[model samples]
Target chain A: MEKTINLTLKVWRQANATAKGAFESYEVKNISTDSSFLEMLDILNEQLINENKEPVAFDHDCREGICGMCSLYVNGRPHGPDDEVTTCQLHMRKFKDGETITIEPWRSAGFPVIKDLIVNRNAFDSIIAAGGYVSVGTGGVPDGNAMPIPKVDADEAMDAASCIGCGACVAACKNGSAMLFVSAKVSQLALLPQGKVEAARRAKNMVAKMDELGFGNCTNTGACEVECPKGVSIANIARLNREYLKAKCLD
Target chain B: MGTFFSSSIGKKFVMSLSGLFLVIFLLVHLSINALLLVPDGGEMFNNAAHFMALPLIKYGLQPVLFVGFIVHIFYATMLTSINNKARGSVKYAGGNNTKDVMWASKNMYVLGITVAAFMAVHLCDYWVPLQITGNVESTTLHGTEMHDTYALVNAAFSQCWRVALYVVGALGLSLHLTHGFWSAFQTLGASNSLWRKRWTVIGTIFAWVVGVSFSLIAILQHFFYQA
Candidate 1:
């Protein structure tokens, strides 16, 4: 049986990073329960366009939940009320009829809002650029199974690699700490044999960049793990700390 | 190294290391204090206290301990302020879900401040008089003349208000340690899943041990051994 919901959205509206932002309420009627949250916003945007009013702006790409572009704090949770899923994957079925949902962009000093529901996430890019890649010589691809990687190490590496960098962890954190995201990048490389060569340097540089970028320190609150779309473990944060401490010790 | 120490994680690492050092000191302090429970009329405690007050520990290790406290408190305040600013000016319309985070973990600064405040009172009551003023009465025990530190401790704990303060302080320290013990390990990179789980359990047990033991002495002194 097909169902529909009528929702009242209190979406944050801001002209730019410097402008004052506020929540503007709008009624979205008869939205199909099967439509994703982003789709429902699309309907509202279309209505605003027809009325000749400025439409709401939100960032989204690869709606399949992989691009890590959709960032929304729906009802106090990153990516709506859903666990381990992005905003685009949130469906109307989870909402109640006439329920008022509040939406806002990622709130952090590191992520300044560009407009409504869109914030600058280039801080992450900068941190990654600092030391997220492995250095290797230009040559033909290494033969498969050339490196006998333990299955456990490979699995853990893959798990850490699952992070799409959606910035949900920062939105959900009370301190706005990006430890989970930074740790994912650090751990993904640290767990692999190829990334072990510069693990210490990578850890120090990435963490230094994260702090320089104005991200909060991780207090082991576990909020980031709960709200992370990719289920990035806080253990990765522990590894980053270890790698960092080891590097400092050697220095 | 100075730059690393100035970094956020470096500050956290320093905090955790200092915290763990304090935790170990507490265990040693508690064991020596436990001698009061013996019916030996403060002989064992006085001897132990005399040894701890020796020039080696008093002048050398005591300064290191003081530095540890200073560093811990300094970074704690610094990190708290920076974290508040990092959260940005806009408050979330809906508050965070409490299920995802430990109450102790979220309010660590408050608990730390509570413990720090109590530490002031504690030093005023004990350390100041014994170390600086040398006003603590002396007793000859085991053929050695030493400050009757056990007498001072007993007199303080015998009072109901003093016992109450100590109990409250212990509770604050317990909450601080509950989050801090494992968190320090995590901050230092004990993030493996199995070890993290074990650390949590061990941390909880350690917190209780320190809290209950400290409070027990105060309550016992108040009720059982009235000065």
Candidate 2:
């Protein structure tokens, strides 16, 4: 027998932060358990469009769940109840029929609400802009493995580079903190020899840029890790601390 | 300050300094409170309280504690804000992401907010009342009224639910302070990677000892003294 489920969704809809926002309820029915959660949403949107209703707009790109684009808080959990899986990869089977799903965009002063189920995450870019890049251009002046990085450092750098910048850390944070995200970025560069030249400058500039963007402080709560699709370690935060201290002392 | 303040490294340095300061305060507080668990009862506890209440000590250390607490919270807020801002408009494709952090450390902000909320409660229960009333007054086991802070401490930690709440709150505090302690030292220039690793471990142990000692004393007193 084919299993079909019906669910209620109360999604946040706002033209922008300047505009008032409210939860609008919509019913999605006869959903296949095998269908991905986003597919279910696509079904709902299709229904709305057929009825000449404005569809709920959301941000997403690689439905494969590689891009950190699909940012949704389902029933108070970022990326829904599936542990470490983004909404795009979440199959409807994880949910039951007749369930109420509350969907909202990432909420943070830094990531402003852009529209219905969409938020502006440019604050991330600015932080990256602060010092995320190294001074490497088109033509490589050296071989790929020219700089011999230690195994441990290389491993740590790879781990840090795994950060997808999904903004889930911000959403899951009660204070809307971005410590996990920032730490990952810092750890990525701080561990590499190529990242050594401007290490001090990078840490200082990025941190300053983070504060200027209106994000909250890291209270040491681990909610970001729990909700993060990528399990970036809080240890990177410790590494970031060490880097910052060195930078400050040198300065 | 702004030049350093705005820098990522600068913020980490600030966070570490504040964290180290808090850790020192925790050790001192733990030692003092451990007196409450003494079988001699209120004599040792009251005397210690009295020493803390001395004019010079009270006026001087009290102000410093307040400043330390404020600076710790302020820097935490500033650091978190910067991380938030840097995330600006962008998204990622969800994939195989594994976290290296414990559940409690990542939620430090939430735990911190909880701790901060309780700080206000703690201050009101003891500090405000004592300051406003001019002094502590109550009956002791020996029928002496000598600055009986034991009574207030007893009343606060006795209620079943209140004790439970404190235990939970303390757990959060312990978890938070543990991570913050090592992380902070590393920020302030702890030797190299090897030394930093060792210190991180030491920091975690210290945090647990201090946190558990305070919470256990509260619970034990709630059982033994209250009865």
Candidate 3:
């Protein structure tokens, strides 16, 4: 059965990056339960447009949970309350009728608020730019099955590769640590043959950049894994520790 | 290597290694403490104390133990400060509100401070008198002239407030260890998905035993000791 509900939306508003932001309450009514959270926001924006008020601006692209763009700290959780899904994937049914949903941007020093419900996640790009890619020779096509990559390594690499760099791990982390994101990036590449040659250098450089960028250290609280939309594991963090230590110490 | 220790993972490695070392010392200390319950009139305990008082352990390893403890606390404070900075000055009106993180894992530094506070009391009641001040009365147990370390412990536990202090301290240490044990393994990269679960279960059991047993023995001595 289809359902529609009324909600009190507490949306954040800021004119620019330096402008102070605050939650401005507005009533969004008759929202379809099946509509995505973003669509519900679109309805609210239309209402705001009819009122001749500035619409709440939030980052969103490829609203199917892949673009890693839509981020909202809704009611104290990053990407809203729906489990293992982005804010765009969150359906209105997950919320109660007449519930006042508080939506804010990702709060972290590494991710500063740009506007209402939008923060700069370019720090992640900086860490990736440091050493997140595998160097390729780029010549003739290599034969498949020649290197004989282990199945476990390939699978684990793929799992780590699922990270979308959305900064949810950072948003959800108590310390604002980027360990999960960096570890996922590091683990995905380090597990594969193409990335192994530069693994040591990658670990050292990436970690250096992460710390340099003012991210906190991991204390293994496991909060990052819990709130991650990608379901990325903290085991990659342990792997990163192993990689970094091997590069810095015994290697 | 000079500058590598300043990295985030490097700091964690230091914290875990220092913590694991203290974990070893806990076992040794607990084993000796168990001797307090032997009921042989402190003979075996005094002998063990005398052996522990031997120059090598008393002088050599004692300093190392202190260093390990200091390193753990120092780096923890430094890291927490850095983490606070990383968290920024912005207070999220909506809190993290996460229930998945273990209580001990989140409150490790606070628990560590509690344990350290207890250690100050502990050193005053036992270590200071026995090891440094030489104020504990001497006794010849089974023809062995020793520092009457058993008497120092027994007399202390005999007091109601003293036993209560120990109970609090032991429980604090226990909470600290529950997270520290498995977390140290994770930091050292010795744990995975399967092993992490195994380590967490093992660590919880180990924490309860080590913590509550101290309370048990303290209660026992406070109520049951004679002479």
Instruction: Please tell me which predicted candidate would have the highest TM-score against the true structure.
Output: 3
Higher-TM-score candidate of 1 and 2: 1
Q: Candidate 1 vs candidate 3: which has greater DockQ?
A: 3
What is residue B34's positional error in candidate 1, in angstroms? 1.1
TM-score of 3: 0.97
Give the alpha carbon lDDT tens digit for every residue of A8-96 in model 1: 99999999878999999999999999999999999999999999989999999999999999999998789988888999999998899
Q: Give me the runs in candidate 3 sitting further than 4 Å from their true place.
A: A138-141
| Residue-wise C-alpha lDDT for candidate 2, range B117-195, written one tens digit per residue | 8778778888876666755675454464456787778788888887787777777788887777765654554544476
Candidate 1 DockQ score?
Answer: 0.67
Highest DockQ: which candidate? 3
Off by over 4 Å in 1: none
Cα deviation of B122 in candidate 1 (Å)? 0.7
lDDT string, candidate 2, A165-242, tens digits: 999888877557777899899889888877887888888788778867777666555678778788787677666666
lDDT of 3 by residue, A1-251 (tens): 78889999888888889998788999988899999999999999998899999989999999998889999998888888878899999999999998989898998889988888889999999999999997766356678767788899899899999999899889888788999999999999999888988999999999999999999988899988888889999999999999998998755
RMSD of each: 1.8, 6.6, 1.4
TM-score of predicted structure 1: 0.95
For every prediction, compared with the true complex, DockQ reads: 0.67, 0.20, 0.76
Q: Arrange candidates by lDDT, highest first: which order? A: 3, 1, 2
Ranking by TM-score: 3, 1, 2
